[model samples]
Target: MLLDFGCGPGRVAGHAGRALGMRIIGVDASPDMLALAREEGTPGAEYHLVADGRVGGLADACADAAMCNHVLASLPDERTVLEVFTEIHRLLRPGAPFALLTTDPACAGIEYASLRVGEPGVSYGPGEAMPVRLRRTDGTWQSVRNHAWPVETFPPLLEGVGFTDVAQHHPTPDEAVGVADPEHVRSRDWSAERLRPPLVVTTAVKR
Candidate 1:
């Protein structure tokens, strides 16, 4: 079985469950998100609600693989981040893979030339937390407080929680940047700096 931590509206879980043809357990803190997941998710997926970053209802070592997407950024502090990591570790079988995706600390303040979002920017400093504001499709903005940690801080934190062989991946320009039309491409016009991604993806093994 696979576990989707902070599954939100089951966007990933629903697609993954259908594609992989496996049982997927999706857990999130928001009841509204859980409700949406249950309403829209594939048959292979199940939704659960968690409290205080704890998945207390799940059995120990129940999952073969786990994913936490866009979650670390929303954590209020390092303690909560550690708790979530620890809980993920506890839920995975030995040597199971855990994938994490979050806001990239490296490209905190980059302004995209092609992609458009309401005031798309990151606010942070070296060794400091990042706070971000993102605009939804509805044109409303949501604030993500304490959304990112220094890039240097992640390795040690994963190691402390008994994770090994951590690897980070940055999306390429074609993957990160969206093109409205195939024929009317202006990717070449974007500055090299704008190609720097705003998100980071990492994978680690539970030890």
Candidate 2:
């Protein structure tokens, strides 16, 4: 089974289950998100609510792989990040793969069509904490605060949590850019530098 850690509204989980024909377990901290997932998920997609940094009701070593997407940067602190990592480590079978995707540290002040980079809420340096505002298709705005941890910070943490073979992957601008929608004002800009490696993806195996 595949576990989707911090799955919001079951988007990724549902897609993977339908597209790959995999059994998916989605876990998230929000009751509203879980409710939506249960209502609008794929045939083999199941959802669990996380409490106190734990995925309640799930047994240890229950999954073949786990995916965390856009979740770590939103964590309030490193302690929480480590706690989540430990929890993910606990849920995976031996040699199971753990994949993580988060904002790149290099995306601080760059401008993109869908997102506008704002001033750092905590510090002005790359790999520092900052606030970003996202523009929706309907012209609504959502603000998010994220920690831009250096790419180097991931492997050691994964290793500490009994994960091995940690490797980092960077996507090129062509692979990273989203398709532009003429109807949406916030559609992606194919020419923006922010489209270049806006995310960092890491994969490791549970030991």
Against the hidden reference, what TM-scores do the models get? 0.79, 0.84
Candidate lDDT scores, in order, read: 0.74, 0.78
Which candidate number has the best TM-score?
A: 2
lDDT (10s digit) by residue, model 2, range 48-86 = 988988988999999999999988777766688888899
TM-score of 2: 0.84
Model 1, residue 141: distance off in Å is 6.0
CA RMSD, predictions in order: 4.3, 3.5
Tell me the deviation in Å of residue 90 in model 2: 0.8
Q: Write the per-residue lDDT of candidate 1 for residues 153-181, one digit (tens) a residue.
A: 67788889999999887755565334234
Which model scores highest in lDDT? 2
TM-score of 1: 0.79
How many residue pairs collide in each prediction?
A: 0, 0
